[model samples]
Target: MSKLPLEGYRVLEWGLWIAAPTASMMLGDLGADVIKIEHRVTGDPSRGLDAGYGSKTGRQSLYEGFNRNKRGITLDLSKPQAKTVISKLVQTADVFITNFRQSVADRSGLDYETLSKINPKLIYAVITGYGSKGPEADIRAFDGLAQGRSALAMQAIPEGPVWVRPALGDTVAGINAAFGIVTALLVRQRDGKGQKVETSLLSSLMFQQTSNLALHFIGSIPVAPIPRTRPTNVMLNMYRCADGKWINLYMPEADRFWPNFCKAMGIEHLRDDPRFKDIWVRAQNSEALVSVLDPIFASKPRHEWIRILKEHGCVIDIINDYADLPGDPQVIANNYLPEFDHPNYGRIKYPPMPVEFSATPGQLRRPAPEFGQHTEEVLLEVGFSWEEIAAFKEQKVI
Candidate 1:
């Protein structure tokens, strides 16, 4: 098989929930061998966070989604023997990821300082709420809080930042960590050494709004003199369809597209309308345009509008929910959704590795493991004896 970007890499994913797990998933997509370490009894807290819907938990979905093509192991790292086992795994691991709080990792003996000693060439990746070193580092932060403090919510929504249904911070930081780890791996390819890489939800939020942040240092940006209450209601906006579906009309300027869009909506007169020919005129006439177009759009179903606007090449998108995302034709054509058989769940659906390889393609090799599923085997790889393993299990340490 042709070698993928990370064909020879060994990654140990000691992460819970969104960010860190997503990074591991990316590596798995690129053909790296990843080992996901979980506690023996509880596993990741996210596993149980979802209540059983129809007697099946979303946790099952998350485990499969975030952690396909990876090995799983159970260890009670609280035990000395487990730490010994991990030290050996570190020796072979090229990349190590953890989202544990600094205090927790330090207490658990998984801090970079401790693990780096075992494998100085390991690329250590970290995802934090705020950051590892800051006044707010020790303070607990979630995506909503970061989005709020970073002015993302205020600038966009204004009423109050809505808690995103999905964990955007985790996914963004995960991508950052993925890039950082890959860069570190590339550096190691040249210098034959490893380095530390870190990202935080707050930092990722700020990065996502780099343009907004730059306004502070450079100068204040000119806000369009539109009497819009929220940013979403700017020049481009979402319109509700007759069937109660929403479509985004996203031409941020009163340009060719906007006129074409109004024409498509059967209100071609808007092109010559006195209050909307220029951007300034459109700014004064936004409410009138929305009022006129709303009923016209409501006269036709979203599907019909989609077809007509698409023919004319208007920039539009049908608002998609979770179900719509997976079933999208483009997503399917791109092979973004991949399914595999799980040990307990039988056949399961998981998002495929995101990278494409024209040669030997990447794959989702394994369903997420059962709790501590590979403990004995991984310990054996590190030269631990049966007696030592038994004693550690008896002590509830791994």
Candidate 2:
């Protein structure tokens, strides 16, 4: 196999939960050597997060899922010796990442300025809830809060605001942070200097909603968002089938697809119906059209409709939930989720990064490490002798 793109790079990360550690994992997937620094007291809080869902053993599946292909160590940064250890690590690291709030970062000497002074070529990435200079810079933020602040929750609901699940804000922000760090590395290669890269959940969430924002800002028109429950385009909506399965139709051009769609659904006579004649009429009478088509769709199973609609070249798809994803043909064919033999979870699967490369593909090199699993190993690499490492441990500064 070809070497991954980030081979030979080294990353030192201090992150909890998702954002910074996830960004480090991205680098690790592409073959960077990432060393995660955790608190000696509890390690990453995410490790025991599964307990809330009744996994009594405090299963770290959530942490393992996001933190693949990295080494880990424990550290208590409150100790003065911890700063010395970080300074030594910074001297050789290509990138350093942290998700500490502004006040905490500054006080602990983990701010970009301090670390950059140790290694001028180090790419410092700071993940935050908001931008560093904003009024809310010191405030803690999580996926849901950022989603709410960025109006992502509002857009998701369409009817009224509600938080979107599955921690989209953290995932997007981590991806963006990884992208930013890579871009900074490229810039450093050209300029012979590294820079601080900043990204936030708020920024990432806002950028993810760019199309809607463009509709508001660039279109220069009063905004009226579409409600998913009552979408104007009847064709661009989801319907339930007789077997209680749901499917979605996304035919954008009503004039073009209407006749074929109607014929496929055995409702050809309604194609020219006065109430549902054109796109404009359909928008105005979508509810009435839905009322007419509801039982018609419920008359057949989802698979049958899929076959019929596909035969007629109508753009349609089954609405797959999470339970259906792992076994999906497209997902398997594309290797979107790859299976691995995990030590704890047995044969498990993980979603791969969305990107692929012909020569330098991403990889799953190793599983997430146990807490402090590599403290002695990593410290030795950074020039700490066995005696010094033992002393650091005794001082709770590892």
Candidate 3:
């Protein structure tokens, strides 16, 4: 019922895959009019990507997930006629977002320098793989590559680095870019001046691990990869139960919950034991403590342990798999995974905007547009005549 936070803003997105589109998608979710520009012929490459969840209907979950709440248009930017269209769109856009490499952007005249010259007040957001000014600035990068370069992949066990799935680097970079764009919008509102905003998957990945990476940066220590079975804190680790289901505990203030935790586990005699008397001692003797707790946890099913621990006010939770999310009560109550009847995919769910605003809540007004679904409408909004639109279409420019 309330107007959304980003109402009255216009965003022009020239992106593919996840990062740049994701930024625009968030802006769209917040009520901005986001026009997603794609290649005239092929559209977004992700549209065809199967992602292992592909259906006989040829729907792409990846593209669908990232591109909702936006209008779609196509433009062959290489064509000179397309430049005229882009210039018109830029003049009316409050923000312009792209994740193209530097050379690609320059060649297509979508770089900040060129676009800003067209509209002096345009907030240009650039998402890159490395950064805008580094040695690898022009290098092409994807989620896996950025994660590997950012040392996130190396945080795995001694067996080797693990590749995280579902595009962690890209998603984080996109979220960071959206945050930067909103901050820039505030500055623009204050001074009526727009500037270039930049973020990279590498930088975002590093930011994600700031607390862990701080040890290496501040103490000048080479951080070793985490070992699978070696936990720094016994109380802050996961245990397998009698049913083979895993449950994780998080009593960081172990001393405060020591007696209650012991009572819940029916091991109150061990509460006063010197070897596990406090957080520090438990951490120091974590291996020994794990040995003591493992068999006890294995004595009960996950549900029983969960009930007992929660009854005793111990911080605990079950490790849910992907299939558990759709039915999760907390997830449903918070609307983290909202459902909609997609035209091609039938009934499905996608993640919505994570933050909630009491006064100005966001909404999913529409699904991601079909390829070039709004080209004519968007062109008319930007001041192109119907004749020009038809001519551009005849010339394969839109």
On the 0 to 100 scale, the lDDT of residue 55 in model 2 is 86
Candidate 3 per-residue lDDT over residues 225-314, each given as its tens digit: 644256766777899999998999987777788899999988888887898887777767778878888899999999999999999999
| lDDT (Cα, 0-100) at 118 in candidate 2 | 93
TM-score of every model?
Answer: 0.90, 0.97, 0.94
Q: Which pairs of residues have clashing backbones in candidate 1?
A: 74-372, 76-397, 76-398
Between prediction 2 and prediction 3, the one with superior lDDT is 3
List the candidates ranked by lDDT, beginning with the highest.
Answer: 3, 2, 1
User: By lDDT, who's the top model here?
Assistant: 3
Candidate 1's C-alpha runs over 4 A off are 52-59, 215-219, 222-235
Candidate 2's residue-wise lDDT over 1-398, tens digit each?
A: 67789999999998889989889999999999999999888788899888878887656888998899999999998999998888888998999998889788888888888988999999999889988886788899998999889988877555678888888988888999999999999999999898999999999999998888898899976555576445789899889999999999998887899988889988888889888889998888888888878898999999999999999999999899989998899998998888888887788888787888888898887899998999999999989999999999899897
Which candidate ranks first by TM-score, i.e. highest? 2
RMSD of 1: 2.8
List the RMSD of every prediction in angstroms: 2.8, 1.4, 2.0
lDDT of 2: 0.89
Q: Which of the predicted structures, 2 or 3, would earn the higher TM-score when compared with the native?
A: 2
Using TM-score as the measure, name the better of candidate 1 and candidate 3: 3
